[model samples]
Target: MKFEVGDKVVIQHSNDEGEVVEIINDKMVLVDVRGVKFPAYTDQLDFPYFKRFTEKKLFPAEKKPKKYIDQLPPEKPAPGKKKERIAQLADGVWLTFLPVFDSDEFGDDVVESLKIYLVNNSTLAFNFSYTLTYSGNSDFNLDGALPSMQDFYLHDIPFANLNDNPVFGCDFSLMTPDRKLAEHYEASLKLRAKQVFGRIEEIRKKGEATFSFKLFDEYPLRPYEEEKPVDTLGLGKLAGSGFRIYEASNGAAAYGVGEERA
Candidate 1:
């Protein structure tokens, strides 16, 4: 019955499959089916993977093997060219911008595409929603959770759009696993337009592999502060032995003692 957001499950009554989006309580959860979300009890859901194994018969169905084309590895920059840079956005989160190049049919001219990655590098897991903005009026959204030490690919931004909308900023709202609903932490990450665009142009002219920059390395989020422990040692002894107060004025002195009469 254990479940968390992003886990795949099959609904009991409908027998439809979907991902767990929100957990209401010990017995309830919300699931996303296609684009619609429905409330379902935890007891009514089963692991989708297990169902596939249970439904398969002893005899395997005959099917033709599908051929897959091997993808070429990303091209590497020349030895002297700059390398890729990874930037830390918040406490356990990292960001990086990359340019991927493609060649024309003749393999003479090059085309460029941009991609941004947001990585989770902390011990704790988190669910997050993000907004990336540029040009002052344009924006895009990427919503999902990244488990501990995982990575999420944002999207491919076309090279043509960079000129009109150069500078970019990202805002993220994250909820940690321990206090998923209690605390909503926010972080704002900014990437300068000049830096990115200049590098791209330089790499293009130099025929380098790609352009990269390292910014805001391991920037930390505001940490949670725990309460201090109470002092109990001396207080217990002082309560048992009571105390005495002595006052002196000029040459005259007065003394008072207090203790448990019993």
Candidate 2:
């Protein structure tokens, strides 16, 4: 008999019942049994209605009175809440690369691509700008704010592009509320093909998912300078000194005394 989709059928040799999900051909059909799909011959499947009716008629079910209890069963105690544990990381900004592998039945794996991430493991928040370049050509550029103890995702690099040395540059500034601005920090890293291959081999040996290199240990800050009143008239220092100030061609001040320029 031919089976259509959505027809309930039973296997001819076994008691397993399933639904015909798709008719592959005149002789083959797709059956879904317990949420698993497999191909079976159409002749091996039959309608389950006859089998269910025959079983119900041959062995009739007996009905019994419902039992009632005076007391309810004890309830199970609720489980206590678990405390969350924070991960402790080293203090620095890091550049990490995670390799994606494609493996075959021969157990040989090839690197398909790489996932890049910028890790900010320090306590300070910073606004950062990043640029990636190869062979004097810019590949990627991004600017954003990164929170403390967080990671930012950069673009991926294909395995083939690793042969070309890529340069990564990052500029960071503190996100502070103070009026005095701190000096910006700059860092650059150049990746060579040999260096990356060595790191990848190391990761494969150690069974690590990612390889990381520290960009900087700590963020540098500029020294704070006290404010002082400006000398607008420039008369304070000229009171006793006989030197005369002359403006040079380069817009610099030249001092002279008695026709002798210094």
Candidate 3:
């Protein structure tokens, strides 16, 4: 029970080694284990000289070989080719919700949020405008061009937002270079809270990352129009009627009239 300052002692009933820093009384003394100091009874601590000598002789410490900078192993070269992104989505434009789970383990996983994506699975490029509304109020809006067979990340929606009745609307126009013009396709999706929960359950059961709804199977194209011959005469007659040609102005008005008729 005699513990003095600067004495290296082993705390009894444990392998903690500390140095006595102060003697509170004949029984309790302040001991510093590593950097932490605590009061301990003198009877609970003993000199570590015999224990240290016995351990050093019984279990000799193994010396590790010193590693030099020149002796270190060379780093391996990185791979030349990168992995390609691949997805086997159906041939349609899809609004996909990828659930981000709170836990990575299987079963009882909770969806933290959902990553929204506009997936263009068909062979058509489109300039798209997307909007998300909550409770009849616009919450998010994005505009971008989506390429064929690729997915565009819109934004993330918290899982709790499903209870507020969010509506996702998208308008798409073909990125065509031809003179033909088609009407912009508009699509909207609104899912109930129960429906979203059901989809989450289905995703968990199927071990899939995303639950998607098809927006459109095929992108609508402009109806084809038959080309007509240009009428060179101003006699108010059709070109196919074989009328005799007269003096006419071959300027912008002639081309404009032909285009308007076509």
Task: Specify the highest-TM-score model's number.
Answer: 2
Candidate 2: tens digits of C-alpha lDDT, residues 1-262: 8889999999776678989996655656667776645556677778898677666755557887765675557769999732210112367998877666666588687777777878887878888999988887999999988787777778778878877778989998888733454568889899887888899999669644568888899887566788988979785688558755545553342333335445
Compared with the true structure, model 3 gives a TM-score of 0.51
Decide which is better by lDDT, 1 or 3: 3
Local accuracy by lDDT, each model: 0.59, 0.74, 0.75
lDDT string, candidate 3, 24-58, tens digits: 55546667777655456666777888677666756
The clash count for each model shown is 0, 0, 0
RMSD of each: 19.3, 16.0, 19.8
In model 1, the worst 10-residue window by lDDT is: 81-90
What's the TM for model 1? 0.39
Task: Please provide TM-scores, in order, for all candidate models, with all chains considered together.
Answer: 0.39, 0.54, 0.51
Q: Candidate 1: global Cα-lDDT? A: 0.59
Identify the superior model by lDDT, candidate 2 or candidate 3.
Answer: 3
Candidate 1 residue-wise lDDT, 1-262, digit = tens: 8899999999776687888997655555667876545456677789998888889899878987875566556668867622111322344566555565566688653435576766665555666676766766646877787665555667777766665654444444345433423344555555555667677678558644334333223434556679977756555456568754223442233322343346
